[model samples]
Target chain A: MIDLSTFLKEMISLPGLSGYESPVREPIARTWQPLVDELSVSKLGSLHGLRRANVKGDHHSVLIATHMDAIGLMVAGLDDGLLRVMSIGGLDLRILVGQMVTVHGKRELPGILQMIPDRLQDKSKAGSPPGITDLFIDTGLPINEVSDLVKLGDLVSFATPPQEMSGGALAGHSLDNRASVAALTLCLEEIRKFNLAWDVWAVATTQEEETLVGARTSAYEIKPDIAVVVDVTFAKGPGVTDYHTFAAGKGPTIGVGSNMHPALGKYFKTLADEMDLPYAMEYMPKSSGTDAMAIQVSEEGIPCAVLGIPLRYMHTPLEMVVLKDIQRTGRLLARFITQLETDTMEKIFGERKA
Target chain B: MKELIQKLCEISGPSGYENNIREAIKKEVTPYADSIEVDPLGNLMVRKGKKTEGGLRILISAHMDEIGVIVTHVEKTGFVRFGNLGAAFPWYLPASRVLFLNGTRGVINSEPREDNTKVSTIDQSYIDVGASSPEDCPVKIGDVGVFERPFMDMGTRVASKAMDNRSSCAVLIETLRQLKKSPHELVFLFSVQEEVGIRGAVTASYAIDPDLGIAVDVTSVGDTPSAKQMEVGLGKGAAIKIRDSGMLCDPRVVRWMRETAEKASIPHQMEILRQGSTDAYVIQTSRSGVPTGAISIPCRYVHSPSEVVDVKDLESSVQLLLKLIGGPVQLK
Candidate 1:
């Protein structure tokens, strides 16, 4: 049996941010190379792994996608040894100040995002954080030495490592997505033994944090019959109400609504119930702003579904995830792939589906 | 080009109701069309390219609809209330001239307020359509009204109502009119209800699943005062859209259009609109597969009754489309 937690830890330790994803991409390709029947990648850096079945045309060609990119910052400008930074993705300015980060400049250097204090009185003003212009990174070196190591547009990432807490929870950066990639890798490990009859595609998508470009290009290139996206959803936490967030410590979330195919969503729910696995029915009510959004509209619409692992502090440096929830998501996806068939695909959607 | 665009901007077509502009486009396209068809949803499909061998189904789309208001109720004293169709900023609607779909002109009046008084809203404002009383009203509930149509020539810049997209539709018609023999079978689709929610392209894409699609729309220009600092601007020529907030356009199609413009030496610029969307959202992922891109006429004050654009840009768009279609079918 593969240790899924170990794989997730390895993935979360690396910092492959929005545009600079080659670090995570190379290691992921190495792990997925031997698991699929065919390997193809998009110019935008989407890695797809396929495994065809022993029986001919018995399985419906299906694509399971998980994005591997994380959100970070770039050195917009430099002042003294402290570099002024701009976030590449959405950043909650409240937690950004005083956070330690790894500066991927000409060479890797350690830095910290800090702010200058003004003698303003109101706490309201303090609570309302300043723009990127107000944030800067302190590189312990002198101005001349720092200038030699760091240049403009150099990527900077949070310096938190994957830490396992006592309550089956793992904390680190990029768990919003990298953990999903780890779950995908575990699914590939189980799928090698199953003699299912269908073309199974496992894609480690890129740049999902910034835009839907990777999924957009990959969906066009592969043009699969059905698509299932795996990503993270915000979980219940302190000061959190039901309106803004869902319950944490729950199992994976099964999305149902207009954009997601209703049948495919119901299929996953039924499968989870039959297996007695923990799951929840969440309604996106519209096109989900994940990889599923790009996949559903590709090539006359694909019957797509999203399975989410409950995560905490999404889009932050130290996001939280349950270790067992990862295993559950892996097993459920592997089961879906092993059971994929052409008749099932046609039945879920009308015969118009290719 | 300036005169033609001026004529097009003077027309009006709001979402879910575009008959007046539909009939006007029919007149323009009828002369050049071997056949033309208008669906029940009010989308006009004009077919040209009198060739038989290409087997190509290419859709050239430009939305005919613009932002406007729908009369929700009529209060006493002939004060008509309304709701906006698209992103008409609440602050930009106080004193603008509005016209009903049936050619009834009115003024959007905000009630006078003291410094201590609250500002009025869409629900509070009234359309003075010169009606004597509620019983004498010609424009009632459910009637659509827009900024009164006007085409003004300010030196080289032309400003008119519904130019957000009507400029593109006119260019499509002009391109079809100027074609000798298009190698690819062209479907000049005057899509409807784009401002509401891209309602027409959703069905049109199903009807004509093309090998390739090009959405002719308007992209934001950075040269405007206090505008977001993007590179593309008015009078620079055709603007090739790379990506917008709503869609990630095909990279191959983006490269193809850029190269086409460069090869023909047509002055053009690249656009990355941080906000809003275009018909390209449906064109890229419509049927089976379609490589999609957009050529925009850089226009200012979009969504307002009077959107200002350059006639030079319109001519540049026509030349670029002509070179792309009739010249040589090149694929990257």
Candidate 2:
């Protein structure tokens, strides 16, 4: 049996910003090697693990993609021994002040991300949130040592360790995506015992935080008959209890919008109901802001669906998720894969009965 | 053509919810198309002409989506709070009527400030659906609504809610019906979600991988009072686009469109829109890059409920498109 909590904690501890995921990919490849039959990497460095169909001459394939990149900061310039940084992805800069970070420079250096004092700031900009120009990373070292250790264009990642909270929750940085990676891992492990009719491609895509390059390129290479993109969604937290958010501990969400195929979404909802799993229908009127957006449009166009794990404090260092929701999402994916028949495309396309 | 424009503009399809409109358009083009397929992103691709041995693959596109509002919250007083799907300006929203896909109706209004100031943001506005409370309210969170104005045939100019692109859609439909024979392969794409972004064209063009591309859509004109400085006006025939904010028209494609218009003696004008773009921007940048240009119908008050377009301009656009795509297109 796979321990979900331990796997997630180990994955989140690694530093893998967008477009640079080797640090995290090495361990993920090792964990997924035993669960899959054939493993390869895409040209853009997306990990593709294929488990061929057990009982079929020629079978269709389904790509289950989960982005493994996280948002962080990069050194833009050196400002008098302090590192002036730029954000790699969408980040709420308001919560970035006074946070711990590990600057990946010539050597691993511990630093604190801080904003200049209001007294030192310009008179016109005081009492407002600091912009990227106003923020810096201090390593508590002398100017010569700091300048020698850190170079421009180095990566800086959040150093907050994953913490286990009461009620089966985990909080840390990179939980926006690493949690979904864990869920995909669980699905791969669970589907090992099933005799599936369709080939399964578990893709740990890269660059979803900044550009969807990984999802876009991988889908073109795989050319699967269908795809399901897994990612995290907003959870109900302090000051965020709208319909767009779901309860963290309750279940995952099945996306319903233009990005998702309606028949595929209904099929997931039916399986979830049969398995007695609680889930929400997330309505994304435009972009789902997930890997599905790119995967759905690749090549001749593959029918795609999005599965979301409810998370709290997205893009923050202390983002949180319920461990139970990850397991539920994993089980739902396993059930769907096992239940797919050779003629499942007809049902997915709403052409004829299976 | 005016009736088709009204028919297409009246259907309710915001950026993401394009099912009804897609079905309606598919019905109109089913007889003329050789093959039709709806891509995963809801882009309807219709192939009209057959491919010969060395024929060029051409894609002409027009987006089928419009700007609207999506409900974000339903208050206890039966009023709903919403967000814009595609540039639903707050100043154009108040006192406007809207219709949801499920036949629900509502009127948009803003909260009065204590200091009696004007509401300048969407957060200050709400929609009243004639319900006394949330229990009786037919509107739910995530329901999308578009402007609920009937189409008006104002002499030579037509006014409607979604005339920004539906006028172009009508132009494409007429072009498909009129073109007799062609040596090159033609793909007429009725794309989705162009209002949110040029999303549908990005995927559809990648799938089609055309040799050359043309986008038919509406453009802002200087005919309105004190409008931004522009040379194109309402009745200025077909506007051959040179540049927009999103893309610079492929120079070769621009020259070809202008030369084709002049050779045919179509009432044409050169257009250089300072803002906004069309599907040609993405189709030009599709896989390995395709040389692309656009034919824009001049309109006024774009993105507003009652966008106005001249019938003469629509006819000229259809004529230029037929002449351009009805024969072999050689970029060299």
Identify the leading candidate in terms of DockQ: 1
Q: What is the TM-score of chain A in candidate 1?
A: 0.94
* Candidate 1 per-residue C-alpha lDDT over A1-354 given as tens digits, one digit per residue, 9 for 90 to 100: 557777788888888886457788888888888887788766566788888767864346788989988888877556777897667667777788888899997789989898876455346556567676678899899999988998655678999988998888999999979878888888898889988767778988876876666786688778888899999987988887674466666788888888788889989998888889898877788667689988888876778989988899998889999887888888899888877765776666667553
Query: Which regions of candidate 1 fall more than 4 Å away from where they truly are?
Result: A1-33, A38-50, A53-127, A130-174, A197-228, A235-238, A241-306, A317-325, A336-354, B30-35, B48-57, B114-119, B177-183, B228-230, B326-332
| Deviation from native of the Cα of residue A269 in model 2, angstroms | 0.8
The residue pairs found clashing in candidate 2 are none
User: Which CAPRI category fits model 1?
Assistant: incorrect
lDDT by residue for model 2 (A1-354), tens: 778988899989988887678889998999999999999987556899999898748889999999998989877567678887767778898989999999998999999999878898888988898887678899998889987998654678999999999999999999979999999999999999888899999999987886576788688878899999999999987776578789999999999999998999999999999999999999998989999988888887888989999999999988999999999999999999999898889867766422
Summarize candidate 2's per-residue lDDT along B1-332 as a digit string, tens digits: 88898999999999989999999999999989999999999999999877786678999999999999899999988899899999777778879999998899999888886655565478988999998788999989999989988899889999999997889999999999998988889999999999998899999998998888899999988667876546678998999987665655665687788889999999998776767899987886565456688999999889889999999999999999999988777653
